[model samples]
Structures are given as structure tokens and as C-alpha cells.
Target chain A: MRFAEAWRVALDALRANRMRSALTMLGVIIGVASVVVLVAIGTGAKREVERQVEGLGSNLLVVVPGRIDIGSAPAVSRLDLADVDAVSRVVGDPSRVAVTVASGETVRAGRRSDFTTVQGVLETTPAVFTRRLGRGSYLTASDVDTSRRVAVLGAAVAGALFGDRDPIGQQVSIAGVRFRVIGVFAPLGQSLGVDRDDEVHIPVTAAHRLYGTQRIDGIAVKAPDRERIDDLGARIVAELTRRHPDTEFSAVTQQQILGVLGDILGVLTGVLAAIAGISLLVGGVGVSNIMLVSVRERTREIGLRKAVGARPRDIGLQFLLEAVLLTSIGGVTGMALGVGAALTADALSPVPAAITWWSLALAFGVSAAVGIVFGVVPAQRAGRLDPVVALRAE
Target chain B: MATPAIEAVDVSRTYQLDGVSVPALRGVTLTVAAGDYVAVIGPSGSGKSTLMHLLGGLDRPTGGRLVLGGREVGSLTPPELATLRNETIGFVFQAFHLLPRTSAVDNVALPLVYRGIGARQRRERAAAVLGRVGLGHRLHHRPNQLSGGEQQRVAIARALVTDPTVLLADEPTGNLDTVNGQAVLALLEELNTESGVALVMVTHDNEVAARARRRITMRDGVVVADSAADDPPADSAAVPDGPAAGGDADPTAGDGTERAEAAR
Candidate 1:
């Protein structure tokens, strides 16, 4: 039979049972919609995590100054200038590497003083953290070596201390010692839950001298490239283990953090997709049920068509096509709804929502395949009907 | 000798109902020749419909050989049988089985569409055939919109659309009044005259049976009479409006030998 004729007949048959066909389509619609929405939400959460991770820079590695044991108290090894120089000379790929000596301290801007977590580092610390200077200068190696009390304020810190005015060359106090603000760091959104622009940075020696602390808390490192990250981390760990065999500190790499987050997101996406998949399975059942009812209702019509020279193949095609049409329509509508929902969520949320073309294609393709798989029984039943008995049926 | 248009040699149909075998037709042998108008007359439950079903290839005979148009009916597959029906035979039913939702023209165009005619040509052919049945004006009317006589006429038009060599009507006028029945009978006669298509009608009406040149009477799945109508008297004779009643004095009357000869 010609496709036009076949399509017309199938359409007519569906239209003949309008309520039943619409109800069947409703199953497909809900199934596709939920799958799309759930997938979008999952993808959105993943994108948010990626942005957070990116804010900290892909090559950045955090070195906490302690071996954290499950049942024992963590040992704090005060990170100091000697440790920073020793590690810098000990590590290979010196050109791509930068280090930081991190600690927390109290500071005051005039009468307004706040206890803020401060990172005391050399000039290269901004590059390691992927932070940029928005105003004055970053700490210099000269300042760190001379133990000068010059500070670079984070964007939030600058805003708190100076308001609308520039805080460069202004005096601020850390541990009751006056320091001059050199530069303001640019905004760096958020890393995990911590606002990146809220901390204050000063030279490592100056921070140690002013706070009367002779040690640094930890060091941060950045590798040149992704391929050398593990190599560099291993070298750092081997060197750290050698230098501080008694102190005990660990070097953490980006891959470990990325892998942990990936696993968590993978499970989250899996759980969400599985729940949505259940609805699709329910939709398939709906298609089967509706088609079964259609086959029963149109038994006489099938017989008549067969008697009138319609082949079994024609009958089968008609029913199968009906299901495909129904589900495909649902798939398309659901994609639109899903994309819409994702966009709406992204607009209203601080976290970003991601919609990919492949995701949309997957949603449609799966629905169509499901329709065909589920429609088979009904189509076969109609095709195999005996004309003698069918024609006799009321 | 030539083959009959339809031939049944010891044909039978049996059904198993609740493990009980009920024979609808039992070893019935009959022949219908080209250009012949034959009526199989019997009451309900007499197996007339069963014989019709067997002859039309709508079903298979449980026993014996059946041939239609010199082709062994049992040799054809279901699809082939459907094709045979589409091309070689047309059916009219007692209830005037027109698709309820379709226009009369569309119902008539069905066979042509099955034959794969283009839509435009199908409509034209259906219109022309409906015109032949005196229903040209009612072509667009649905079954519900048309009167009983009009519906039967549309059914006839549908049957004739395929231009089949044989028309099998199972009580074509069963649902119509006397005037409508006469009108349908007249249309069938006109087709038989104009096209020389063989016509087999099943009816319980003696008045209807009188119109056919030959009549086959059935009882208990057996043929009681395969005879002809009486000749009209020379003066003031009424040439029965349809088939003449009773079986005698008709030129098409059976001669045990001509039954064999008419097969030619």
C-alpha cells in the first residue's frame, strides 16, 4: 500500500477512538517529560559542580599540613618559609609551579575589624589559585623575603574595608600590626561553599612576623599541564615525605577531588535517570494496554480490511505506525518542556543548568524505540486475526 | 466440455462447537455457469450461506474439491483468495453492508482502491457505477442518510465497480420493502443483461426466486430442486416482473444433459 493511504487509514483509525488514543499519548507525554526534566536537573547540578571546580583552577592542588587519621587527631605541621623554599627547589618543573603558605589571622580596617581566614603567600600565589588582581599589586618575592607587611585584599575584603573607594596604599592591621594594602584581587565566585573573594592575602614572612607565628599552616601548588599533574604530585609527595619525614604532611591533587565529585554526580544522575526510566516503562505499558484495547475494538474492522484485500503486513504497519506517531509526538513535546524547565531553573537559580543537544536526541530516540518495542504485540494480534471470525464479530 | 464458472464436488463445512461437531454443509455438489442467474433458496439454518461462503472463497471447505473460474479454490492462500474475490467476484449482503461512516460514492470506490486505482479515477468510476444503479444523486449520502432502497443500490454499485464476472448476493433485498426489492431486482437484471456477468442470489422469497431463469432449492444442506420457472401463456401473459415463480416451462430449465452442456 502507498504510504499516504496507510497513513490516512492509521490516522482515521486513531481518530475513531479519540479518547483512547489521547489517553495513550498522555502516558508517553508524562514519560518523556519526566525523563527530560530529570536529566536536565542532573546535568544542571553537574554543570554547577564543574564551575565550582573550574573556579579553583584545574591544576590547583591543596596541601594540608597534617595526616588526617580516621580515629586519631590530625597533626598540624606549621608551614614556614624554609618549607616553601625546600619544596620549590625539591619539586621538578619549576617554571609551571607556584606555592602558597596559608593561615588564618585577625585584621582591622580603621575601627571595623574582622577575624578573617588569611592566606600568606609569595607573589605567585594568585596564579596558583587562578585569581587576578583587580586593583593594586600582589605580594612580591622581595616583600616575602624582607618580611614587609604589605597586603593584597580580596574583592569582598576590599569592599568591606574601603566601600566604594580604592583600598590600595591604605593602612590595615593584622594581629595589631599596621600593614599597607597593595592590591585588590578580582572576584572568583565560589569554590564548594566558600566565597573565593572574601579572604585577605599578605606576604608569608610578613604574616609570620606580625602574627608572631614562626610557621605556615599549608602550601598550595599548580602543575604546568594536566598530563604532568600526577607526576608532579607524586614528586611533591616523595619530596615532602623525604623533607618532613618527622612532621607528616600530605599533597592533594585535583584528580582526587574531581574523581570524588564525578562518582557522587554519577550516582546522582543514575538515581534520577532510573526514577525517570520507571515512568517510561509505565508509558510502554500504557501503549501496550491501549493497543490491546484497540485491537479488540477494531477486530471487525481488521477482518473487513483483510477481506477487502489488505495484507497482514499492512495491518501490522498501521498499528505500529500509530504507536510511533504517538510516542514521537510526546517525545518532541517533552523535549520542549524539558528544555523550558531547565532554562527556567537556570534563570531563577544561582547554580547553572546545562542542556545539551545529545541529551535531547537521546530523549527522543529512546521514546521512539520504546514505542516500537511496546507496540509489537498489538500489531501482531491485529495482523494475525482470522477474517472469517473477525467479520462475524459485532 | 468446458468448466463451470463455479464447481463444487462433494464440498463440506463442519464446525466444532464445545467439542460437538456440527456440519453446516455436507457433501454438496453444484455448478453455476457463465451468464446464468441462479438463486439458492432455503430457510435460515439450511446452509445456504455456508455454500455461498464456500463458493466465494471467503472460507475453506472442510472436505472435497471446489473450483472457481477453473482455478482450484483450495489451492489459493488467504491473500490470494482475497485478491481473487477483489478481481473476480463481488458480494452484496442482506443488510446492505455499507461502511456506516463513508459516503455512498466512497463505499462504491472501495474495490477500485483495493485494485490500486488513483483516487480521482476511483471517484469517477464509483460515480459512474452509482449512476448505473440509479443512485447518482445520492452518491455523497452516507448509509444513515440514504433510504433502504438507496443503500442497496449503493451496495450493488459497489459490487459492480470491480466489473467482476460473477456477483454473489446473499439476500440482497432481504431488508427492503416489496417496491424496493423490485427496484433492486430490476437493477440486477439490467446488469446481467448488459454485462453478461453470472449472478447467484440467495433469497427465501418465492416472488424473488421467480425472476431467476434457474433456481436451486436447498433443505438440510441438500439441493431439493435445481429447476426452472413455468413458461408464460401466449395471450395476456405477464412475463413475471422478476424470476417466474415455480420451476418449469423456462428455456433455461435443467436437462440432466444440458447441466453438463451448460458447463461449456
Candidate 2:
């Protein structure tokens, strides 16, 4: 038979049992839609994390005491202010170096008090990191040299301590010491699950006195150029290791961190897509089952057509076409539904969703293939039916 | 003689049911020529339907050669046999076996689909044949929408649409009322005479068998008699009878007293 004619017959059969056709398509619809939606969610999350990582700064390198690699325990870290000076000489840009020590402390300003994270930082903090002041002047190098009791408040800390009140000239007590708030950082929300806006910054020398610790937590350095980042990290780690032979230091670049994170998210996306594919497999089986039932129901019709003139191949093609049609239509509908759902979820909630064309194409191709894989036995059954027995079937 | 529309030489068929051998046609020999009208009458389970299937190339004989339109059925592959059936034979069943939801014209056009005819021409030919069967006005009516007689006429039109040399109709009038049966029977006779297509019908009704130019009677997996055997097979390719021969048809048309006439 002509190809168009075969399609016409298949179409007629579906139209003849519209309710059955739609019900059979439901399984594939859900399967493809879930795959698209879930993959979108995974892609959206990976992108969000990338944006956050990139937001830290350009050509940024972090040097920490000890090995952060798997299967290695970190040695007791002894990185102090003198080590920071050694790192500054290695980079040849002292203004690009910054150190930090973090502790949770309670701050009292008049009648209002807030428990917040207090960080020790240098005057080069804003230069090495992408931070801005919303009010007042930031800490100066003289303030760190004098061990002055001055502080920079984060946007949230300032709000909590002095609700909409200008905090530049105000006094707040931190770790039981009175300090003047020198500045308030801009409204940066959250990064890597930590509230960036709810912290206070003090001079490194003053923090050491308050916390009774001579060790700094970590160091961040900005490389002069992107191409020298890896070399710069290695040089810094070598210098730190040179100063304290007993302690090992590791310097990590942003790219390496992103690679690790991207690998993790890629696996997550694949896993979610695979889980949704199980539903497609189930949907394929449903198509096969429905095709079998259709063959059984149309046995007499098959007999009649064969008696007139249809070859076994023609009959087989008809049934196979029916199955393919069912899945392809369902696949398209599912894609629309999944895209709509993903966009809706992205818009209404914090969960990010991005619809990638590859995911859509993969879902469509697999759904069609599912029809073929699941449709074969039933179509063969229809073609192989004995006209004699089939004609006699009630 | 025009390659004999069908020739079965001692064709025998045995079916296996759960390892039990049951013979349906025990070496029955027959020949049906082009432009012939023959009726086969027998009770149920008598191998009459089996004979029709073998004659139409729907089944293979176990014992002898069966040639359809000058091609040996045994030598043809299943697909080749299907094509042969499509080219040379058409069928009408007692159930009126029309695709239930399709319009009459489309149902009639079905046979031509396997012939690779385009849609427009298929429909045109189908409509022309349906008009000849007195159903020109019911071209768009589905089976459920049409009366029983109209449905049977549509089936007849489908059979004739292929322009086959032989039309194998198994109990063509069995599913209709008395009036519809008479109408269907008359239409079959008319199409047979008007188109000169060979007609081979299997019927339980004796009166329906009597209108044919020849009659074949089967019993117990064998053909016991054929009414026109006295005449040469080629001579039996006469035209079908007129409408006047319906009620007062020859009682001897199903004449089977000449027993064991076809182990030839």
C-alpha cells in the first residue's frame, strides 16, 4: 500500500477509539514531561551555583593550611599574621592580599542586641573581594596597625543593631569590647548557604586580641593575570610550606572548584533524567499492552483486509504506525507540559529551572524509540494472525 | 481454458490440534474456470470453508497442487501468495465483514489500497463500483448507518471493486432477513452476470445454491457430487441466471446423488 494510505488507515483506527488512544498516551505524556522538568531543575541549579562562584571575584585564589584532597587529614594550621606578610611578598602585590578569622559573637548597641558572625579582615578586604560600602568609610591600614577597636558592619547586622539608623558613627560592643562602626557593607544576600549580609568585620590585630588567637583562618590573593593563577597558587603553597616545614598548605583556584561542582551537578542531572526515563519505560510497556489489545479487538478486520489484498507487511506497518503515532503525539504534548511546568516553577518559587533543547530532543527521540521497541511484538502478532482463525473470531 | 481461475488437483489438508491429527479435506479435486458461478453446500465442520480458503490462496494444501490464476500456490511465498490473492481474488463473508466505522466508499476502496492505487483514483473506482451495486447514494454511509441489505451490497461492491476473476463468498446471504437475503442473493447474481466475474459461494440454504450455474456439495471432508460434472469444466463457465430464476429455481441444482464424483 501507499505510505499515505497506510497512515490514513492508522489514523482512522485511532479516531474510531478516541478515548482509548488518549488514555494510552497518558503514560508517555507524564514520562517525557517529568524528564524535561527534572533535567531543567538540575540545569538551573548548576547555573545558579556557577553564578555564585563567579560572583566572588576574578583571578581569585584561596590558600589554606593543610591538604583538602580526599584521604588526607589536615595538619594543625599555624598560619599567622607573619605568614600573611610572606604571602604578600610572594605575590609582589601587598594590596591584593587578605586574611580572615571568623567567630560568632553577640553585639550590643544601646537597647538592641544581635548575635552575628564576626570576621577579622584587613584594609585590603574590599580590594581583593567584590564588596562595597553602603555607608561610612571602610577600615584603613592604620586601624589594623594600631589594633584599633573599629568595625565594619554587614548590611543585615547594621539593620538588626540599629534598625534603619545610620551606623557609621555608632558604637557597638563585640566580644565585650566597645568598637565604633566604621562602615556598613551593601546588601549581599547569601552565598554557599551562609548569610553574607549578617556579619561584622574587625581589624585582624584586634580580632586576635579579642579571640586570644594568633592564627588566621585562611588567605585570599588575587593573581595579576588569569594565566598565572595556577602558577601563583603553587608559588604561594610552596612559600607557606617553606616557612613551616611541618605544616602543608593547599592553594585552590576557582576553576578547579567549579569543575568539581559541575561534575557533581552533571551526575545529578543525569540521575534525575534516568529516574524519569523509568516512567517512559513504563509508558512504552503501556503502548505495547494497548497495541496487543487493539490487535485482539481488530482480528476480524485484519482478516477482512487480508482477504481483500493486504500483505502481511502492510498489516504490520499499519499497527506499528499506530504505536509510533501514539508516542510521538504524547511526546510533543509532554514537552509542552514540562516546559510550561518548569517555567512556572522557576517563576513562582526559588527553585530555578532552565529548559535545554537537548533534553527536549532526547525525550522526543526516546519516546518514539520506545514506541518502536514496545510496538514490535504486537504488530508482528497482528501480521502473523491466521486469516482463517481470525475470520472465525467472535 | 484461460488458465482456469483455480485448479485443485487432489488437494488435501490436515490440521493438528494439540498433537491430534484431524483431516479437514481428504484429497478433494476441483476446477473453477473464469466467468463461472458455482455454489458449495455442506453442513458445519464439513471442510467447505477449508476448501474456500485453499481456493483463495489463504491456506496451503498438504497433498496436491493448487494453481491460482496459473501460478502454483505451493511454489509461491506467503507474501507472493498474498499478492496473488490481491490481484486475482475477492471475498465477501456472511458477516458482511465491512470495516464498521468507515464510509461505504472507503470500505469499497480498501482492496485497491494494496494494489498501490492513489487515493483519488481508488475512491473514484470504489464509487463507480458502489453505484453499480445500487448503492451510489449511500457512498458516505457507514455500516451502522446503512440497512442490512445496503451493508451486504457494500460488501459486494468491495468484492467487485478489485475486478478479480473469482469472487469467493462464504455464506453471503446468511446474516440478512428474508427480504434482505433475497435482495443480496439477487445482487450477487446480477453482479456475476453483469461483470462476468466467477462466483463461488458456500451456502447452507438449498434455494440459494439452486440459482448457480453449477453446484458443489461437500460431506465428511470430501466432495461427493458436483451438479455440472457431466459437462466439461470449460463449458460450465456460463453466465449466471436472470432474476426470474430466483423463487422457481431448479431443485436439482444441488444434485448430489451422483456420489464419490470428485476424488478425480
Candidate 3:
């Protein structure tokens, strides 16, 4: 038989059993939809991590204090202001790096009070951290040199404390000491659940007196050229170890963090996709069962067709086409549903969800393969039927 | 001197039922030429249906050679036999075995489907055949919407759509009432006489059998009588009567004694 005629006949048969066809397609629909939605979420998480890592600035490396092992005992190691200055002197480029001494503190401004993070850094902190002021000017070299009690408020912190009021040049009490707000940072949306716009920035010397802490938490160094980031990171680690003789800190480049995050998210996506594939297997089995039943139900029709002149291969092709039609329709419907779900998730949650064309193509191909693989046995059975016996069947 | 439409020489068929061998046709031999209208008449177990099946290539004989349309039927492969059935012979069953939900046109077009004909050509040919069978106005009506006689006509149309050289029918009017049965018989007679297609019909009813120009009577898987060669009995002389003879024409038309006499 011609393919077009066979297709039309198959479609007619499916339409005759409308409810059964729809029910049979349900399993495949759910399977493909879940696969798409899960992959979208996985991709979304990976993208969010990349964005967060990118937010730190270009060619950036972070040096954080690590635990030191001594005689089989792990001891907490500290990175202080002296170690920061020693590392900077060894690197010999003071303009390319900035150090941050951070602590959580309670701040009060008039009738509003909230706990917020405070970071103490040099006047060049804005350039290194890729931050811009929405209001007043950033801290100047004189402000740091004179031990000035000036602060830069994050966008969220300023909103919380001043609420439509101008925050620049206003005095806010940090750890019970008054500090004048020098600027308000621009709005930077949250990434990975951490709001970047919810902190206050201050000069390093005044932070020491206010919080009574001499230790600097971490230091961020920018490569003079993008290609030198790894070498710069290695030099900082070597210099810090030489200065302290304890190997008490770890220098992590931005690419290292991104690589780790990518590996973890990739595995997560793969695992979710595998789990969703189980449903497709179940759907395939459902298709096989339904096809077997259809063959059994239409035995006399098969006999009639064979008696007229249909070759066994022709009958097999007809059934196979029917199975493929069912699955391809299910695949397309599931794709639409999955894209809608991903879009809905992106709108309702902070994390982004995305559907790629490759996933759609893969899902369609898998569904078609599933139909053919599962449809073979039933089609073969239909093809091998003895016309005499089939005609005799009621 | 074209080849006979069907030739059965000492054809034998056996059935295996629950591990026991039962013979359906015991070395029966017959030949039907093109454009001939032949009917086989017998009781239920006389193997008339089996002989029809063999003629239609629906089953192969266990012994002896059967040829259809100049091809050796027993030697052909399954697909080759299917092609023979499609192009050389057409079948009409007792049940008017039209596909239930399909329209008359599609049901008639079914045979052409296996011939690799496109749908439009198939439909056109099918419509032409249905028109020949006097079903042109009911082309789109499904089988259930048709009367018994009309459905049988559709089946005949399906059988003729491929324009086969022979038509094999097993009890073609067995399921219809008297009026519809006569109508189908009349249509078959017209097809045989006008279209010049060979017709081989299997029927136990003597009146239905007499409608054919020649009759073969069977008993216990063997042809006990053939009316073409020997003169039929006085009561069985109603063969010249038309289908208007209806159901109650003659009571002793195909009695066993007359059949015996006809065989002699």
C-alpha cells in the first residue's frame, strides 16, 4: 500500500478508538514533559551559578583563610591586615588588588534598625569589585588615609534605613559608633539567593576600631591582563605562604569555581534526565501492550486485508505507522507543555528556566525510536497471521 | 485456447483437528473455464467450501496440482499466491465480509490497495465498479447503513474492482432473505452473462444452484454428480427458470435420487 493511504487508514483507526488512543498517548506525554522541565531547571541552576561567579568582576581571584594541619590536628588559621600588606608588597602592584575585612554588625539609623554585613576596604574597592555609586561619590584616598568613619550603603540597606530619603552624607551607627554614609550603591539583583545590594562598605582602619577585629577575611586580586589570572593566583598563594610559612590560605581563580559548579550541575541534569527516561520506557511498554491488543482485536480485518491482496510487509508497515503517529503526536504535545511549564517556573521563582532546541529534537527522536522498537513485535504478529484462521475468528 | 481460469487435478486437502487428521477434500478434480458460471451444491460436510477456498488460493491442496490463471497454485510462494488472488481471482464470502465501519467505496477500493494503486485511482476504479454493481448512489454509505443485498453487491463490487478473470463465491446469498437473495442471484447472473467473468459459486440450496448454467453436486468430499455432461432429471429441469422462480418453485428439485441419476 502507498504510505499516504496507510497513514490515512491508521489515522482513521485511531480516530475510531479516540479515548483509547488518547489514554495510550498520555504516558509518553508525561514522560517527555518531565524530561524537558527537569533539564530546564538544571540548565537554569548552572546559568545562575555562572552569573554569580561573573558578578565578582573580570579576571578575579579570591584568597580565603583555610585550616592548617599541624601534627594531625586541624587548627583555625587567620589572615590579618599585616599578611595582606605583605602579600601586596610581594605582588608589587598595589593598584591591581583590594582586600576586604568583613563582619556582620547591627546598624541603627534613627527609628529603623537592622543587622547588615559590613566590608572594610581601600578607596579602590569600587573598581576591583565592579560596583558603582547611585548617589554620592565613593571613598577617596584621603578618606582611607585619615581613618575617616565614612560608609557606602548597599541599595537594599539604604532602602531599609532611609526609605525614599537620600542616604548620602547621613550618619548611621555601626556597632554603636557613628559613621557617615558616603554613597549608595546601584541596584544589583540577587544571585543564588544572595542579595549583592544588602551590604555597607567602610574604610579598613575605622572598621578595625568599630568592630574590634584585626583579621581580614579575604582579598580579591584583579589580573592586569585577562590571560595572567592563573599565574597571578599562583603568585599570590606562593607569596602568602612565604609570608606566613603556614600555607594557611587557598587562592581560587574564577574559572576554577565555574568549572566545579559546571561539573556538579551537569551531573545533576544527567541524573534527572535518566530518571525521566524511565517514564518513557514505561510509555513504550504501554504502546507495545496496546498494539498487541489492537492486533488481536483486528484479526479478522487482517485476514480480510490479506485475502484481498495485502502483503505481510504491507500490513506490518501500516501498524508501525500507526504506532509512530501516536508517539510523534504525544512528543509534540509534551514539548509544548514542557516549554509552558519552564516559562511558568521562570516567572514564579528567582531561578531562571530555559528550554533548548536540542532537547526538543532529542525528545522527538527518542519518542520515534521508542515507537518503532516497541511496535515491532505486534506488527510482526499481525503480519504472520494465517488468513484462514484469522477469518474464522469471531 | 487461453488457460482455464481454474484447474484442480486430484486436489486433496486435510485438516488436523486436535491431533487427528481429518480430510476435507478427497482427491477432487475440477476445471472451470473463463466466463463459465458453475455452482457446487451439497450438504454441509460435502467439502464444497473447501473446494471454493482452494480455487480462490486461500488454501493450498495437500495433494495434486491446482493451477489458477495459468500459474501453478501449489508451487507459488505466499506473496505470489496473494498476487494471483488479487489479479486473477476475486472472492465473495457467505457473510458479505465488508469492513464494518468503512464506506462502500473504500471497501471496494481495498483490493486495489495491495496492487500499489494510488488512492485517487483506487477510489475512481472502485466507484466505477460500484456503479456497475448498481451501488453508485450509495458510495459513501457504510456497510451497516446498507441492506443485506446491497452489502453483498458491495462485496461483489470489491471482488470485481480488480477486474479478475474469475469470481469465487462461497454461499453468497446464504445470509439474506428470499427477496434479497434473489436480487443478489440476479445480479450475479447479470455479471456472469454481461461482463463475461467466470463465476464459481458454492451453495446447498438447489434453487440457488439451478440459477447457474452448470451444477456439480458433492457428497462426502467427492463430486457425486455433474449436470453439464449428463441430462438432469425431469424435476431438476427447472435450470432454465429465472430467479423469479423464488423460494417455493420445486420441492424435490435436488433430491439425492435425481442427483444419482444425473451422475449416471
Candidate 4:
């Protein structure tokens, strides 16, 4: 028999048992939907991490203080301005490096007070972190050299302290020291749960005086090109170890961070897909059960068809097509539901969620495979029925 | 000479029931030429239905040879047997066997579907045959919507749509009332005489068997009496009481004998 005829017959049978067909499809729908939603979340997080790392500069590397074993206890090692300068010299180009030191503090503007992070940074901070001024000018090299008490308010901090009013020239007290706001940085949104828009930036010397600490938190190094980032990171790590022989520090390139993030997210996506696949297996078993029952119920009809010259393969194809059609419809419905859920999540929450084309294809492919895998037993059983015995069936 | 439409040479069949053999047919030899309307009648468990099944290629004999449409039924593969049945034999069951929730036209078109015919042609042919069975106006009505006579007619249309060499009907009117049964028998008579299609019917009713020009009475899985002159026996009283016993009651009986003679 032709596939078209078998498909039509299958459709007719399914239509005759509408409630049973729908119930059979429920498992597949849930499986596909969960897979789609979970994969979307995983991909969304990976994309968000990539965006944040790119924002920090594509050819960037971060060098931070690492713990050192002093005697029987683990001591927190410090990285000072001298070590930053020494690493800059090792980098061989003054134009390729920026350094920053941060401390959490309470900032008060008249009656408005908010707990926010304050960072001490050089003039090159704007280029290294891709921060552009929304109003007024960024700090100049001369400002940092003179240790001027000026600050740059992050977009969120500016909004909180001054509301709609411009805060570029306003005074804000940080750790009980008042400083003029030099510029309000452009909005940078949140990434990996950190709000980049809710921070204050000041000169390194001013931050050191305010926080009573001369130690730097971390140093940022920029490669001339993406290809040189690993080499630059290696050179900075070697130079830091040479300068502070007893202390420890580690340098990580943006690529390393992205690779680690991808591995973690990829595993997460795989695990979620596996869990969803179990539901698909359950759905397939359900299809097999229903088809077996259908074959038993329609034994007389099968015998009649056989009497009319239908071959065994024809009957088998009809039932198999019915299974495929059921699962495919469920897959389509599940895809729509999954995409709807992802879009809803994106709209309501800070975590990004998106449906990719590959995920859609995978879901459909798996559903079809499920149909065939589960459809085989019942189809074979129907095909192997004895026509005379089947005719005798009530 | 052309081969007979159906010929059974000492055919026998036995069923294995729980390691015990139950014989259904034992050495039943018969010949049905093309265009011959033959009825096999007997009481239950006489193996007449087994003969019908073997003739239709629905079952193979455990022993002996049964030929249908000039092909040895025992030698053909399962698929080849299916094809033979599809193209050479049509079956009309006692139950009508029309698919429920399906229109009469679709039920008629079912045989053609297995032939790989396209939908448009299948529908056109199904409609034509249904019209022949006097169901043209009721083509779209489902089986449940039709009366017993109408449903039987639809089943006849399905059997005839394939234009097979012979129609094998097992108690075709067993589930119908007298008026409907007589109507169906009359229709079968017309098809055999006018269309020249062979007919093999199994019936318990002597009145129904009387309509056929040829009659075979089975007892204990063997043909006890055959109306055809070639199979005459001394004990002719074994022939049941029917118009078919006289042989001259049917106007077309002479023509059937002449055709059988010409083939030989």
C-alpha cells in the first residue's frame, strides 16, 4: 500500500478515538517542552556570561591575589601598587594595562543613603572596562597623579542619589569622606548576578586614603590582539611571582573563564536533556501500549482488510504511521509551549532565555525516533496475526 | 482448454488443537469453471467453510493441491497468495464486515487502496460499483446509517469493485431478514448471469442454494453429491431438496453446462 493511504487510514483511526489519542500524546508534549525550556535557559546563561566578559574587553586578563600558606595557617596575600607597576613593566607597554582596588562602603547623598561597592581605578579604567561617560568628563591622568577627591557614579547609584537630577557635579560621602562626582557612567545592566550599574569609581590614591588600605585588589592587562592574551597573562604571572617571591598571585585570560563557563553550562544542558528524554521514553511506551490495545480491539477489522487483499506490511505501516503522527503533533505543541515559556521567563526575570533552531530540530528528531522505536513491537504483532483467527475474533 | 477458475485435487486440512489433530476436510475433489455459480451446502462442522477458505486462498490445505485462477495455491508465498486473493477472489462475509464510522463509498474503495490506486480513481471506481449495487445515493452514509439490506449491498459493492474472477461469499445473507436475503441472492444471480463472474457461496439454507445453477452437498469433509454431470454417483438421493436438484429449473443452467463443455 502507498504511504499516503496508510497515513489517511491512520488519521481516520486516531480521529475515531480522539480522547485516547490526546491522552497518549500528553507524555511527549511534556518531554519536548521541558527539554526546550531547559536548553533555552542554559544557552541564555552562557550567552550572558560571554556578553559580560566581552564588556570587560575581549583581549583582557585579570591578575588577583591568591592565598599563601604561611606557617600552619593560610594567609590572604596582598597585591600593592608596586606589584601592579612591576607587572606593567613586565608587560612591556604602559598603554596595555589598568589596575583597580575595590571595597564595599555606604554612600550618602543628603537624606539618600545606599550600600554600594567603591572601586579605586586609574585613568585607563574607561578603556579596559568599556565604560563611557553619560554626562561630564572621565578622570584625566593628572587627576589621579594629584590624588584629586573626585568620583564617577555608576548609572544605578546616580539614579538612586539624585533621581532625575544630574549628579555629575554633586557631592557624595563614601566611608564618611565627601567627594565631587565627576561623571555618571552609562548603564551596563546586570551579568552573572552582579549589578555593574550600581558602583562608584574614584582615583586609587583617594580610595586608599578613604579605606585606609594601600593594597590593590586586582590588575587588568589588555593584549594588543586576542591572539596575544594568553602570552600576556603568562608574562604577568611570571613577573608577579618574581617580584613577590613568597606571595602568590594568579592571572586568568577571558578565554579561560569563557571555556570553564561553557563546560559547566554544556553539562547542565546535557543533564536537563537527559531528564527530559526519560519522559520521552515513557511517552514511547505509552504509544506502544495504546497501539497494542488498538490492534487487539480492531482484530476483526484487520481480518476484514486482509480478506480484501491488504498485505501484512500494509497493516503494520498503518499503525506505525498513526504512532508517528501522534508523537509529531505532540512535538509541535510542546515546541510552542516551550518557546512560550522561555519568552515569558525572559520578560519577567533578569536571566535571559531564548529558543535556538538546533533545540527545535533536536526535539522534533527525538520525537520521531521515539515514535519509531516504540511503534515497532505493536506493528509487528499486528502484521503477524493469523487472518482466519483474526476473522474469528469478536 | 483454459484452466478451471478453482480446482481441488483430493484436498485435505487438519487443525492442531492442544497436540491433537482435528480433521476439517478429507480428500474433497471439486472443479468450478469460470462464470459458474456453485453453492456448497451442509450442516455445521461439515468442512464446507474450510473448502470456501481454501478456494479463497485465505487458508492452505495441509495435504493435497488446490489451484485458484490457474496458480497452485500451496506453492505460492504468503504475499503472492495475498495478491492472488486481491486480484482474483472477492469475499463477502456473513457479518457484512464493513468498517464502522466509515462511509459506504470508502468501504467500497478499500480493496482498491491495497492495489495502490490513487484516491481520485479509487473514489470514482467505488462510486461506480456502489451505483451498480443500487447504493449510489447512499455512498456517503456510514454503515450504521444504512439498513441490513443496504449494508449487504455495500459489502457486495466492495467485493465487486476489484472485478475479481470469482466472488466467495460465506453465508452472505445469514444476518439479514427474508426480504433482504432474497434480494441479495437475486442480486448475486444477476451478477453471475449478466457479468459472467463466477460465484461460490456457502449456505445452510436449501432455498438460497436453489438459486445457483450448480450445487455441491458436503458430508464428513467430502463432496457427497455434485450436480455437475461429470460427478454423478449412484446414490443421487444425497442431493438436498431444492430447485437446483432438477437442474432444468434455472434457465441459464444449460448455458453454464455448454460453457464448461467448451472449456474442456
Evaluate all candidate structures by whole-model CA lDDT and list the values in order. Answer: 0.76, 0.88, 0.82, 0.84
Return whichever of 1 and 4 wins on DockQ: 4
Off by over 4 Å in 4: A65-79, A101-120, A132-187, A197-217, A241-250, A348-351, B16-23, B26-28, B134-140, B210-264
lDDT of 2 by residue, A1-394 (tens): 4577769878988888999999989999999999999999999999998888888888899999987774576556699999999999999989999999988999999989999989999999998989999989899999999999999999999999899789888899997899999899999888767788999999999999999999888999988889999999999999999999988788988888888889889999999999999999999999999999999999999988888877888889999999999999999999999999999999999999999999999999999999889988999999988888888889
DockQ score, prediction 3: 0.51
Cα-based TM-score, every candidate: 0.79, 0.92, 0.80, 0.81
The candidate with the higher lDDT, 1 or 2, is 2
Evaluated on chain B only, what are the TM-scores of all the candidate structures, in order?
0.84, 0.89, 0.87, 0.87
lDDT of 1 at B111: 72
Which candidate has the highest lDDT of all? 2
| Tens-digit lDDT track of model 4 for B205-248 | 99788777778999989888888854445222232333332233
Ranking by lDDT: 2, 4, 3, 1
DockQ of each candidate's interface versus the true one?
0.31, 0.64, 0.51, 0.55
lDDT for each residue of candidate 4 in A30-145, tens digit (9 for 90 to 100): 88898898889888988888888777776888887773222444235478888878887888876567887888999999999889999999888887767788988887788788
Q: How many Å off is the CA of A13 in candidate 1?
A: 3.2
Off by over 4 Å in 1: A15-20, A58-86, A90-123, A133-185, A198-219, A225-267, B18-20, B217-264
Candidate 1 vs candidate 2, TM-score winner = 2
Best by TM-score: 2
B83 Cα displacement, candidate 3 (Å): 2.2
Model 2's alpha-carbon lDDT is 0.88
Error of 1 at B249 (Å): 21
